[model samples]
Target: MNIHFIAIGGSAMHNLALALHKKGYTITGSDDAIFEPSKSRLEAKGLLPKEFGWFTNNINSNLDAIILGMHAKPDNPELLKAQELGLKIYSYPEFLYEQSKDKTRVVIGGSHGKTTITSMILHVMNYHEIAVDYMVGAQLEGFDTMVHLTSENEFIVLEGDEYLSSPIDRRPKFHLYKPNIALLSGIAWDHINVFPTYENYVKQFSIFVNSLTNGGIMVYNEEDAEVKKVVEQATSSIKKYPYSTPNFKIVDGITFINTSFGEMPLEFFGKHNLQNMVGAKWICLHMGVGEDEFYEAISSFKGASKRLEKIAENNNSVVFKDFAHSPSKVKATTTAVKNQYSNRKLLACLELHTYSSLNTEFLKEYKGALNSADTAVVFYSPKALEIKRLEKISEEQIKNAFEQDDLIVYTNATEFKEFLFTQNFENSVLLLMSSGNYGGLDFTKFKDLM
Candidate 1:
């Protein structure tokens, strides 16, 4: 099959392209811009476009399918040409559904922990040598690619994102998966630019829950008030299993799960993650994994990339970088680090990079999100605001929104870096949270300096 990707440099899109390429399909893709990792991976597979930017010539009837990425605008030239030629175009999720429709789909969805839950299930399955197709958001320790597809696999695990499927498809990506087995980790308002209101944002999850195939199984977090409300209201007669944080204890900075079999140590910590583990456990049980086996497999799992990844560590201090930008995520991540190392002084710094984080109205949701940290720092780039076409924010507004009188906010990247360098690393844990780069901060340099 010949597949041409429109705006293929996306994190998920590139992984899909690689998966199709591995399946022996003819894959070609184009994008206006391709960044690191995607560029290098595509180049490695001989799938990188010869040049940047879209070309109408790339669209042709010979292509079996056109996979569209969110990065592509509605009027993208390649997309326009495909439409002009009456070629079939599939949004990334639409195409994923097409590929896995014949299989038992297991989709993990929520405002947070979707990636971690999906990755956990994948790790357990892989440990037991169970063959399955899958797609996860972040890079995992042993996974070579973020996506994998095979005709022989009977199950497919998908990280069900609530974000829009594509520029041309207004529906949430999770709605497209139509999972037979699904999990909703939790819900916290995010992507304010798209949903506009909390009710509207939550309605999307309801749609996702309803989209499941008949007699589907749903695993949800009962501890999340918002998630519990959604689960209780769902009228579907499908089987439902609710889970919360499993019994666990922290010993010498390591988290251990107390199971029926024995006390199982894990490389991951945090109540959010523990809740995620229980949810994943239910999914694994439905997938034919015994409770004992799941625990055995999960004990070896470290974590998904950037969720709470340790970038550098020394005897006296540790540095972590997390893909945590939302209010709930910021709170959960900060609390996890502070709880794990209670004796250490936690210096938590977060970047206001996403549209929601930068919005003045949405800022109030972040109040006390960093309360667990010994010291809290917030950074936002004016250039980022300009690029996102968002209103300029002031340090005073950020401080007031956080309700932390001592909270320091920085609009200058240089000043932020200088301030970070001046902090004492002895008996401290530095947590850097963001969904965007801190104006090209070199993490390696910071690691070396610390």
Candidate 2:
């Protein structure tokens, strides 16, 4: 197959491009700018563009398909050229559906925890040498690429994101995959820039549930009322398997899940993660993995990248960085860290870089999100908000929204980094959460900061 990508340097887009290249498809792509990791990986695979900017010549009638990434606008030059040629254009998720339409798609979708849940299933499957094509948002330890596609695999596990499919397609990405097996972890209002109202934000999940194939399997988090409501309300003929946080004991900082086979010790700890494990277990069971195999394989699972990932640890202090920017994720991550290290002084820092986190109205949803942190610090760049053309935010607003009187706030990255360096690490757990780069912050320097 001959395929060309528009804006191919994205995290997901680059991974898909690499997967197709490995599949022996003739691939070409263009991106305005390419960052590290993506650039290096694509260059290594010989899929990197010859130049930085889009070229109209890149889109020709000979192309079999044009995979449009979210990074590319509807009026993008190359996109227009492809449209002029009457070529088949597929959104990232649309193309994924096209690739795995014949297989039984097991999609994991929710406001948070989607990446971790997808990673767990893939890890267990990989451990048992189960042959399946898959696409997960975060990179797993043994996986070479975030996406893997094969013609023979009977199943494909996908991390179904609820974000917009493309600039032109207003539908949620998860809705594109008519999954034969699906899981919805929890529902929380997010993507305020795309879905303005809370009802509108949640309706996307409802639509996703309704889109599942007839007589499919749905594994959901019954502990979350919103998720339960969505699943119960769906009129589909799917067999529902609801799961909650399994009974677990955290002994000496290690977590163990009490399973039917016995207790399984895990490298990661958190109530939310335990809940995710049960959900993943249900999906794996439906995919033909035995209960014993699931428990044995999951014991070796640490966690997905940037999902409560441990970065550095010393005698008295441990540091973790998470990709938590939404209110629910921030609260869940902060509460998880605090619950795990109850005796330690918890210092949690969150960077509000996303449009929803920076929005004035959406700030109220964050009420008490950082309350579990003994020391709470909130940081956001005014320059970033300006770039998004969002309304300016102030430290007072952040403090009022979080309802933390002693909350430390910083708009400057230098001051935030300096404050971090000056903090006392005596018997403390430090957590850094954000989806952004924290304003050119070099995380490697903090490896030995403890």
Candidate 3:
């Protein structure tokens, strides 16, 4: 198979390129710029273009398929060339569906927890020596590539993202999966630039639910009222399975799960994580994994990268970094850390990096989201707002939006870093949340201080 990629330097796109390259496909890709990790990884596989930027010559008639990334503009030169040649063009998700049409697709979808839940399922499957193809959003501990595809694997686990599939593909990426077994972690409005309103954002998930294959099973979070309502109204042909926070206890700041095999300790924690585990458990069960086997395998599951990932820790303090920019994710993550380490003072700092999180209209949803923290700090960059073409937001607006009169808000990364460095770390936990690097601040430098 001959596969070409546009905007190949993207996290997901590069992974997909490597996966296909490893699968014996003749792969080629182009990007205006390639950053570290993606650049080195692609170079190692001989998939990186010799020069940055799209070239019309790269899009040829011999290519069997062209996979487009979200980073590519609609008028991208290579994309236009491919269209002009009447070649087959597929969004990343669409191409994934084309490859796994015969396999039992297990798509994990929701506003949050999808990556963690998908990672758990993949971890258990790998532990049990069960072979399955997958396309996860985040990098897993043992997986070399985030995407895997093969003719032999009977199932494919997909981290179903609700965002637009491509620059030209308006459909939500999850809608293309048509899963035989699906899981919805929860629904929280996001992607304000695309969906605009909360109701419109939610409607995307409803459409995703309706797209499931006939007789498919949907494992959803019962604790989320919005999730419950969506699952209940889903097509009757699909089987509904609802899950909530499982029985678990935290002892000495460590979380343990209550299972039939006895109390199994975990390397991860938080009520939200526990809830995600329950949904993953149900999905595993449906995939023919027994409760005992699931528990045994999940015991060693550390966690997905950047989802409540422990960057550094010591006797006096611990530091975590999470990909939590949305209002609901911010709240859940803040609450989780506070609940997990009730004995310690919590210093939660969040970056308003995403378009939704930085939007003037969407900022209101974040009211009291960080109230659990002993000290809450919100950071945003005026440069970021300009790049995203969003309305200007002030520190006062952010402070007022959170409804925390005493909330500390910073528009400058230097100021934020200075504030962080001056904080007293004794007997405290620092939770740093954002989808982007906090204005290129080096997180590793602060790791030792923890």
Candidate 4:
């Protein structure tokens, strides 16, 4: 197979390029820019493009297919050339379907927890010596690449993203993978730039349920009211298996799940993760993993990267960094930490980085999101506002939106760092939540300063 990728430096796209390269496919790719990790990994595999930007000369009739990344615009030069050449162009999701059509596909989908759920399934599968191809959003400890493909694996686990597949392909990425087994965690209105309306955002999930293969199994989070409604309305011929948060207890800041075998301790804590485990259990059961076996494997499961990850910890103080910028995620992550350590004071700091988080209209949805924290601090860079071309937001507006009278807001990264430095860490858990870095604050260096 011969494939050329547009915007191949993307997290997912680069992984797919490496997977195909390993499979003996002649893979070539181009991107307007490439960042660390992706650049290093692609270069290591000899898959990095000779130059950065797209070139029409890179497109040729000899290419078997063109896999387009979501980052590539419709007006991309290489894409235009591919179209002019009358070449078969497939969005990354569409190409994934082409490769895994013969295999049993298990796709985990939702606004959040999709990565965690997919990671849990992959961890259990790997522990049980189940050889399967997979793709997960976040990088797991054992996985070399976010994507893996093979001719022999009978099953493939895919983390289904609800974002648009490609510029040319207007469908959500998850809609491309018509799964034999599917899991929908829950729905929170996201990708407002694309979906535009709440009703339209929810309708995508409906389309996904209808797209499942005949007699497929749908594992859903019954605890989520919105998810319950969505699953109940799913008129497909699929078998529905609903799950909620499993019975668990927190002992000395550690979480454990109660099972028939006994209590199994886990490295992760939180209701969302507990719910993720239940959903994963159902999916694994359908894949022939026994209840006892699933418990045994999941005991060693840590967590997905950036999903409430412990960055720095000591006997008295612990610092966790989470990729949580959305209203629902902020609330869940903040609530989880507070519940886990009820005896300790929670100092939760969130960076308003994502477009949704920074948007003045969407700010009200975050009301009481950080109420669980003893001291809640919100930070957003004014330069970020200028970069996004958004109107300047006032500190009063943010405070009013969150409806927290005691909320402290910062528009300068230095001031935020100084505030963090002066805080007392003893008997406190510091939670830093953001989808972006706190304005170039090296977390590693910050740990030493603590």
> What are the models' TM-scores?
0.98, 0.99, 0.98, 0.98
Query: What Cα-based lDDT does every candidate model obtain?
Result: 0.92, 0.92, 0.92, 0.92
Listed per model in order, the count of residue pairs whose N, CA or C atoms clash below 3 Å is 0, 0, 0, 0
Question: At residue 174, what lDDT does model 1 achieve?
Answer: 91
Report RMSD (Å) for each prediction in the order shown.
1.0, 0.9, 1.0, 1.0
Better of 2 and 4 by lDDT: 2
Error of 1 at 325 (Å): 0.4
Tens-place lDDT digits, model 2, residues 162-257: 999998898999999999999999999999899999899888998999999999889999999999999999988888889988788887777877
Poorest stretch of ten by lDDT in candidate 2: 440-449
TM-score of 2: 0.99
lDDT of 3: 0.92
Worst 10 residues of 4 by lDDT: 441-450
Instruction: Write model 4 residue lDDT over 1-450, tens digit each, in one string.
Output: 889999999999999999999989999999999998999999999998898998999999999999999899889999999999999999999999999999999999999999999999999999989999999999999889999999999999999999988999899999999999999998998888788788999999999988899999999998888888988898989899999887789999999888887787898889998999899999999999999999999989889999999888878888999998888989999999999999999999999998778888878889999999999999999999898888889999999999999999999899898999888889889999998988977788547745
The residue pairs that clash in candidate 2, if any, are: none
